[model samples]
Target: YFIIQTLAAAMILFASTLNAWQTGHWAITYPTCPLTTTIITTAIMMKLGAAPLHLWYPEIMQGATLNTALIISTWQKIAPMSMLYMMHKNLPTTLVLLTGLLSTLIGGWAGLNQTQTRKILAHSSIVHMGWLLIALAMDTALATLTLALYILMTTAMFTSLNTTSTKTITDMGTTWSASPTLLTLSMLTLTSLGGLPPMTGFTPKLLILNDLSMNHLLPLATLIALATLPSLFFYVRMAYMTTLTTPPTTTNTKYT
Candidate 1:
C-alpha cells in the first residue's frame, strides 16, 4: 500500500512537472498540454479506484475497522472525484468513458462471490464511481448530485452495519433478532443501493440513463444497466440474509 501511494504521488508530481515545463505555469489548467492533462487524469482515476487500477480498494477496506472503512468508502472519494470534476472538460473523453464502463463491469463481477460485507460495499463504491464518471462526462451538475446521493446512502449503510457489528453475509443473517427495525431499514437501503425503482437510488440512475441515451450513448447506457444486475443480485442476497431468516434461539437482546 505504501508503495502504491508513493507511486501515485510520483505520477501526480510528474504530471505537474510536465504542465510547468510546457506552459511555464504550475496551474493544472494548461490548454496546450494535453499530455499533462492525460497524466493528471490517469492519476486521479487510480485515486478514485476506477477499474483496471482498482485492485487495492476491496482488500484495503476489508482490513480496516468499521469506522475506518466508512471513511474510506465515503470521505476519501471526495478529493479525487473533486479533481476529476475540475478536469472533466480538459481530460480525454474516450479514456474517461472506457474507465467508467470497465469499472461498472468489473466492480459488479468481482463482488458477486464475496462473503465479506465490507468488500462487497467497497466494490459497490467502485460501481457507483463508474456511474458518477459517466454522469460527469455528460453533465457536471448531475455528477455532483449522484455523488451526494451515493454518500448519503453509503453512510446509512455503514452506520447500520457498524451498529450491528456485521462483518459478513452470515453475520447479517442473524441481524433480525438484534434489531428488526434496523434490519428493515437496511433492506430498504440495499434496495436503494441496487437502484431499484421507487427508491432514491433509482432516481439518479434514471436521469443519467436518460441523459446518456439523449447523447446517443445508448449502447454504453445499456451495458451499464446490464452490469447492474449482478450487483443487485448480491444486494438481494444480503437483504435475504438480514430479513428472511428466523432468529436463533440464542439471540441476544442487547441491540434491541
Candidate 2:
C-alpha cells in the first residue's frame, strides 16, 4: 500500500538523518537509549496519528463509512502502538509526557466547535490516543490494559453508530423517537469517550494521570486533565443537542 511504503520511506529518511547527525568521523552509530528511543518512537507515533499529528484522522474518517472508519481507527492505527511497545526500553519519559499533554490539549480544543458527528468522533479518538500515549510511559502491564479497554469501548460505539448510519448529533436526536435505546447508548458512549467513570474509558485516563504524576510530570498530568474537560464539555453539548434539543425545520436532511 502507498501508506505503508510512504511510512517505510519516511523511516528510512529519518534513520539516514539520524545517522548523518550522530555519525562519527567515518562511521555511524545507531543511537539506542531511552532518550533516543523515545524521540524515535514519538516521531513514529506522530506519523501514525499519535497526537498532534492527529489532524488528518477525523477528516479521513468522515469520508469513510462506519466499517471503514472502524478499521482505520482500530486495526490500522495499532502500528504505532506496536512500534512503541517494541522499543519501550529506550523511550524517553519527558518527551512522552510532553506529547501526551499537547495531544490532549489540541484534540479537546479542536473538538469543541465541531457539529459534524464524524469530526467529533475523530477528535475524540485523538484525545483518547493522547491519553494512551501518556499511559505508554507507565508500566507495560498498565499500557496493555489501557489499549485493550480503549479498543473495546471505541469499537462498541462505532458499531452502534454504524448499525444506524448515524452521522450527526442532530441525526441522532431527531430520530430518538424511533430508537431511544440507540440515542441513550450514544450519549453514554460520548461520555465514556470523554473519559467519564462508570464506563471503560475512565481506567485509561486514570492510569495516564496516575502514571504522569508518579513520574513527577504533575504539570503535564494536570494539563491532560484540563484538556479532557473540553472533550467532555463538547460531547455533553452534543448529547444535549441530540437528546434534548427540539427539532428545527429542514427542507432537506441529506448529508452534504
Candidate 3:
C-alpha cells in the first residue's frame, strides 16, 4: 500500500507538471487537458478506493480493528473526495460514469459471499463510493450529501460492531445476549446502509436516482438499482441472524 501511495504521488506530480506545461500554468479548471486530467483522476480514484482499484481497501480494512476500519471508511475518504469534487467539472464524464457503475456492481456482487463483518462493510463502502462518484458527476451537492449519509451510517455500524465485539455474521448471533437492543438497532442500521427505504441510508440513493431519471440517465439508474439488491440481500441476512432467528439455546441470565 505504501508503494501504491508512492506511485500515486508520482502520478499526481506528473499530471500536474503536464497540466502546467500545456497551459503555462498549474491550474486544472480547464477540464479538457487530455492526459493530465486522466492521470490525476486515476490517481484520485486509487485514493478513493473506487473499483476496479479497490482490492487493497477491503484487505487493509479486514485486518484493522473496528475503530481503524471506521476511520478508513469515513475519514480517509475526505481528502481524495474533496480533490475529486474540486475537479468534477473538468473530469471525463464517460470515465467517471463507467468507473462509478462498475464500483457499485463489484461492491455488491463480491460482498454476497462474505460472512466477515469487516469485509462486508468494506464492500459496502465501495458500493457507497460508487454512488458518491455517480453523484459527483451529476451534482457536487448531491455527492456531498451521499458522503455525509455514508459516514453517519458506517459510524453507527462500526460502533455497534465494536461494542459487541462482532467480527462476523455468526458473531452477531452471540451479541444479542450482550445487548439485544443494540443488536436490533444494528440490524436496522445495516438495512439503512443497504439503502432500504424509510431509513436515512435510503435518502441519498433515492435522490440520486431521481436526479438521474430527471437527467435521462435511465439505463444507468436501472443498472445501479439492480446492483443494489445483492448488497441488500447480505444486509437482510445479517438482520435475520441478529433479529429474526431464535437461536436454539436454553440459558438464562438468572439460572437459579
Query: What are the RMSD figures for all models against the true structure?
Result: 3.9, 5.4, 2.8
Go through the candidates in order and give each one's C-alpha lDDT. 0.89, 0.72, 0.89
RMSD of 3: 2.8
lDDT digits (tens) for residues 1-256 of candidate 1:
5666667778889998888887888777544577877878788778888897899989999999989999988998898887787677787888888889999999999999999999999999999989998899999999999999999999999999999999999999878877878988999999999999999999889999999999999999999999999999999999988899865677656864
Off by over 4 Å in 2: 1-5, 12-39, 249-256
Q: Model 2 — TM-score against the truth?
A: 0.82
- Flag clash pairs in model 1: none
| Alpha-carbon shift of residue 170 in model 2 (angstroms) | 1.8
Model 3 whole-model lDDT (C-alpha atoms): 0.89
Model 2 root mean square deviation, Cα atoms? 5.4
Runs in model 3 deviating more than 4 A are: 29-31, 246-256
Q: Count the backbone clashes (under 3 Å) in each candidate.
A: 0, 1, 0
Cα deviation of 184, candidate 1, in Å? 1.2
Clashing pairs in 3: none
lDDT over C-alpha atoms for residue 186 of model 2: 75
Residue 101 displacement (Å), model 3: 0.4
The TM-scores, one per candidate, come to 0.94, 0.82, 0.94
TM-score of 1: 0.94
